[model samples]
Target: MGSELRQAFSVIRKAPELISPAAPTPKEFKKLSDIDDQEGLKFHVPSLFFYKNSPSPALEGKDPVKVIREALSKALVFYYPLAGRLREGDNRKLLVDCNGEGILFTEADANVKLEHFGDEIQVPCPYLDQLLYNVPGSDGTLGCPLLLIQVTRLLCGGFILGLRFIHTICDGFGFMQFLKAVEEMTNGANSPSLTPVWQREILNARDPPRITRIHHEFEPVKNSRDIFLNMNLDDMAHKSFYFGPKEIASLRHQLPFHLQNCSRFELITAWLWRCRTIALEPDPDEIVRLSFTASARGKHYNQLIPPGYYGNAFVYPALCSKADDLCRNPLEYAVELVKKAKAEINEEYVRSVADLMVIRGRPKYTSEGYFIVSDNTRTGFDEVDLGWGKPVFGGIAGALLIISFYLKYQKRDGEIGSMVPICLPLSTMEKFQEEMKKMTEAPM
Candidate 1:
């Protein structure tokens, strides 16, 4: 099936062009938050949303490319920073020039229909590159288009929107806000219901930066258990694991009554971290870390970061444990660690991370023995409506080598769950699947 899909799917794209704002916007430079310009967020992140043709009379005979292109131009008037070019100043601090340079846009036509993919589109999509072409020299962080979008029309009137945005510009929630703005324009709204805000200074470092908390996320490690460093890309495989109601029930059954009430994110992250560590077969005494980002927007610091502030406003909290202990302990052991790490992300924790970035020269998140899980199930990526009804499939186009995303999934029977995409070495993948099977197949 994979080979056939790969052979059958193809996209014929037009020359990419710039889409500027429909109206004039501010002509000035906007500084990025400390969390925005971090070394870990210096690259582009890709996401794709597939929309089946809507049956609504309002959307009938609508050209998605034309509607979206025009709507994007209008949306950029408020999100002008996205239409601008990124520039780096002294200290490697990043800022948007906000010069109305326009964002990269492309229109394409695909040979296949939505059904060609399958009932459910899985991650590590085979034709992601074809769907979203990476134009030469467009992925850099300095003086380049911050947002790149491609609209691919399918044979069955469905369309796929492919986006590649600079991570430094916005986090997942912020990006979704921008897309929602575009959706508002497509629906005939004059402007976004929520006004765009660029008060990035709210997340700036202190006058004299002071590290108030221990931030293990940025700690440098020597002689680390970095498995990916020695392995080539070809040796790894990506697969999506679905956790439906039954599977979740099975997993819950494995835990004690008290631990069974843990949130799905904690349960899944703990299980995957332990299973992944066992699969890698790292040294028993070696330290393994589980890293995840927690948003501070609506937390205790909600008053600090106002709504519509589209920038990086999250903290990377990491939990560490010995491989032997992590693999040998009960499921509750891992859950407790995850809960502890998540509970520590208060306002002070965020401030300390910002201070740490300045004090440590903006070090990247440590990758050694790291298993990162990002929960997108609640991000509302799937619910984005743009004239065409909600997308059939939405979220990250594929999985990264080190980071996995917990995406929303709904089965034909209407059972809703989470879909996690994981990439691992081929040999390790087999072992990982075995571990996962054991968890799901365990007796009630």
Candidate 2:
């Protein structure tokens, strides 16, 4: 077969400069307020991709930049035991820059006209917005330790693979335990069979970080630098909104008659929080806020941790109301206010937000203050096989400015629902796809 497809395209053109000298930053790791589970805070920024077919001929002579610098030095020494390094407080032995990391591959040469399978697995998507931008920083270059691309088929004869991650260092079961430690270092397995647990002073937070008001629901923004010292929104030009799937199943069957309890991810996040309060038409006494992401280890906040714990488990409930009480609610009262904002995940509100990030000194929450729901449909994307298979598409990358909702649920011919994939703000995606085709037509 053409000498085994020129020896697997010479082992993927020498695997990205042998994995860019196994890069690692955050000034060289250790900084979730000096680790030890003060809510274990780093290492889960992955960028995966692996579609096959195009490499044959015993993988030809081999030499794509020395097989991408030997697969980025075996993925930067296999992300040193699944990432860890944050030190400073109680002088926990000094090392704080933040988050262990390394991984970024790219090789785009397709032009569009796509659709294949004869050779199997294909989804090209013309260099998917340049392999999504990988954005996460606070020193650690934000995030992107996995991005293997190789779609060379003129327009669509074969080749497709894409994966990306960085939802604050792991969730979705600590990112599948760092993808089962990169599949035991791609099978050569000398170690990393799995067992990485940090400890972050047992998810700390209340030493001296209290605010007190607790009720009046949500208004706190007095001076967290006054919401980025006020506005700029990139001088206007990032508005997109599309709601299909039959207008997300007619707003989840009429938002359960208005929050009596309609689910479909809380009525498509309560009609995207009433379409960002009717596109900031806001005024019903303003005060709007709505955040999402509550997973401190599920099963009703699983006893806080200690079993292969990874980092930044989860939190950010937020959920306030009033822009005409979330645009005259009805989708089951905005899915019972998104199930009362996921009953605010407990464990003392994730150790009082890591003691309010050590009383607000460890700060870093700017995607424009929140509305970021990512559920990657139970994060598995075809259960990332890796033995040399299972991946036609995966997501999350450099996502900024919020309104990022990714909730996959593949399959399609045999049947499987939810797919979501929204990332709006491209100038309000054609009036959000004309109010999502007037809620997926049909009701005449």
Candidate 3:
């Protein structure tokens, strides 16, 4: 009986670290070419936020070293593949690879203090205000020299864990999965339940693939027409806001022609398209697109991948409308355009996208006008149940204004979804809020 108990205890034993919590940057970084990845070239990384009370009730009494070490151990287990990237030949590819690593953690230097920006801080990036633009060198690695954990004197305490992962290895979903697994492992799980999908052949570029000419369909940036369509167009300022149950119910009643109310995702997307066109103030001849990703692991693509498999298991589906066409059209027409975009999600389209990337010889390209709408409501945010408690709140630390969409549940006043947190450009956020308020308050 005593031996058995000891064996059980061994499973959750704490891991020891030779390097202290406050180590400076590592000496060498791996290069991007070694990874042979297009995503390696793009260094935008996402941040995941969580709020929690410290393990000890006394906030100032808590040990930053202990907390950081525990977090590092958990990160090591969850991001084991990152260590593999460190071993790769090219330091350039390793630089952008989030998987490549020696763990770097920092606590507040004795002289430095944590500052609270309130709701304003909620919208801004926590470290250096760089947000996703913090670039890793040609190598896919970043130097995370410091980790500032706020020790609230009274009740307030917790951490905003930020990871600057190379976007090429995984997307937000994959990152969330990694975080969840780390939390689980810290609580004594041997291995993460997630079966990371690595079947590269399924999405491999076609051999001698015939590429399509439809790339020119997008709007080109002025002063740099040489850049592909929608690459670095004039910056359109926007703002961020969310829709809750109240606002959505109002929209159901406002629309004429027998409204077919859709899911929160479909409804919000349509509303965005409608409002965006209004903001564009565009020519009648140009086409504007509303785009979103379709999950690639459905019944049709089941043969291509298993359900738990992961990678970029998504394909972009776009809806095109003449700028004026969307503005003059009824709300239902916008809804239908989103529905049509949904239909474009298929195996063939996914394959074609892969083939196109390959045929183009995987050239480095940048674009700003493409809007990608993604819903993370289904992502296992709530699944991060550590022994202490579920996260009081969780979200993305910064909103990428250029071309990104992310949605998550909002918890407020002991209720979820007073409004779902939707991210958008700062310029358009107020209008979005007003629209949501009007829609939610409108009669059902």
For model 1, the run of ten residues with the poorest summed lDDT: 119-128
For model 3, residues 148-188, the per-residue Cα lDDT tens digits are: 12212112344434345555555556666666665665555
Candidate 2 vs candidate 3: which has greater lDDT? 3
lDDT of 3 at 25: 30
Ranking by lDDT: 1, 3, 2
State which candidate has the highest TM-score.
1
- Candidate number that wins on TM-score, 1 or 2: 1
Candidate 3, poorest ten consecutive residues by summed lDDT = 145-154
What global local distance difference test value does model 1 have?
A: 0.88
Cα RMSD (angstroms) for every candidate in the order listed: 1.3, 17.5, 10.2
Q: Each candidate's TM vs. the true structure?
A: 0.97, 0.33, 0.71
- Indicate which candidate wins on lDDT: 1
What is residue 316's positional error in candidate 2, in angstroms? 3.5
lDDT of 3 at 436: 52
**Candidate 1, 3-113: lDDT as tens digits:** 687787789999999999999998998889887879988878898898887835776898999999999999999999999988888897888899999999999999988
- lDDT of each model, Cα atoms only? 0.88, 0.47, 0.48
Those runs of model 3 whose alpha carbons end farther than 4 Å from true positions after fitting are 1-41, 54-79, 84-100, 109-157, 195-197, 210-238, 256-261, 363-369, 418-443
**In model 3, what lDDT does residue 301 have?**
76
| Error at 198, model 1, angstroms | 0.6
